[model samples]
Target: MTSTTTTGQERKAPGRPRNAQADEAILDAVLTLMAEGQSAAAVSIESVAAKAGVGKATIYRRWPNKEALLIDAVRSMKGPIPELAGVSARADLIAMVTANRSSRVQEFGKVTACLLPELMKDEQLRQMHHAVMEPRREVMREILRRGIASGELRADLNIELTLLMLSGPSMAQGLFGTETGVPLEEFPVVLVDALLRGAAA
Candidate 1:
């Protein structure tokens, strides 16, 4: 069902400038379909074009191919940079890892662990992932920066490498993360305790 009118507040009201709604619809359809575990490659632009009710040009105008499109969809679904305003950096960091559903993390993990290697060979795909992941990664970096500044964390810490170390265990649980046999509620606490102890002032 395609509508001619836009759907937002007065200023932003004309939500989709140019069939933007259709583009959004296309992305939404792709996510809904991909969630069923379909390989991103097996999905076709024609299908998305049809689903979004826009011409194929519309999709390509925004994304060159399925991978780019999928990455965009993933970025759209990205949750707010997990943070606890005004809390201790330690508490904020713990909330960052714990507040969200690990299942979402695992789903992303499976895609990254499996698809990334294959995509790595393609420069376009690599850049696409960077474009998608960079903003979110910056959020974590900022969190660490705040911790370092406030003396809750050691300044000598390698924020970049530290990110991997901090996120490693949570991600290492593999494909289904929780299926790694760790309990749901315990993940953030265990990860926080370990990471904090290592980085503590």
Candidate 2:
């Protein structure tokens, strides 16, 4: 005699089919909430699932947890790293830093800062943050390396340290400098000029 599997007990498919539109919708929903300064406490799977117009199951099928979903949303804020060639190192660095300070990136950074305490306590969240940030860091290293090679920057300039110097202020501002997200009008200009001066060969 054949046995029957009860409801919610049947062997599920290995996985549900991928849905591109649904994925985009979910990410957009997360960004929308973050840009509005919604607290992490308010952003749960149930809420995002509803905002995305997909079931909670769909979200779980992809992310398995809230942190993973949030990480992906932050990573998606950076569409593609722009080409860093075809310009002077100073010009390139300025463009790169300014481009990253765009409205969407700033919004994502602010949300990340807001969630920093919790993220720091969790290994998985820290790993995801590194994974998202490492590529961008590498790109800046390449630019700095080029600057050194071209005699624009000091030959002994430490790439990693310089990257930290350039990016740290904006990140701090997002985290603690302002509540309304101050405009980076002269921030990039002032920061870049100071960095180049210190590193100039």
Candidate 3:
């Protein structure tokens, strides 16, 4: 009765109306299992169904395979990109960084840490992860480009390297412990300021 859209096309499945509650339970079940240190390969459809309290047929009606289900679960957990203020590159970068760190710490931080190592090793899953991440990366790229064009950042700034510089440490802090001792509340300011010191026009 419900339809899902992909790539601008609506896909209607022949079944009863999709249950929103059931969908949430299934995705939450996947995150719970992953957070508990279960590898993607270890999470079977039956196990997910058992944990979600849905019949296997219910899951099958929603997802074609375990990988598809897992990807959807991860996507659900990722949430949307935070709306940028678009006032200044420095402010936008800080906002983006702050939201990312908060999301990692408050959202499914453990689930991500547990999944990344295993997921990155698989070509298909790696590609899927890239697909999910690329949009966010592009946003950052655009912000950096704007900064350079607007004379806020050095024209010679290497956007790719700057992107890594902006994101790498926050990601590391999320995966490992926050060794920087810069409280999460202050990290974005500290990070963006430091980068701007060298990068500012």
In terms of lDDT, the best-performing candidate is 3
CA lDDT scores, all candidates in order: 0.62, 0.70, 0.75
User: Per-prediction count of colliding residue pairs?
Assistant: 0, 0, 0
What TM-score, to 2 decimals, does candidate 2 have? 0.70
lDDT of 1 by residue, 103-145 (tens): 4544555554555565667896677667556655666688889
Top candidate on TM-score is: 3
Q: lDDT tens string, model 3, 84-186? A: 8888999989877775665534456767767777788879767776776677778889999999899999999999999899878766776776688777689
* Candidate that beats the other on TM-score, 1 or 3, i.e. the better one: 3
- Candidate 1 regions with alpha-carbon error over 4 angstroms: 1-39, 46-64, 83-86, 98-103, 176-182, 198-201
lDDT of the structure predicted as candidate 3: 0.75
**Tens-digit lDDT track for model 2 on 87-177?**
6778878777876676666666777667656666789677767766676777788888888888888999988889989888788877775
In order, what is each prediction's RMSD in angstroms?
6.6, 9.5, 4.6
Ranking under TM-score, best-scoring first?
3, 2, 1
Where in model 3 is the C-alpha error above 4 Å? 1-18, 102-107, 179-186, 198-201
Q: What is the TM-score of each candidate against the true structure?
A: 0.63, 0.70, 0.76
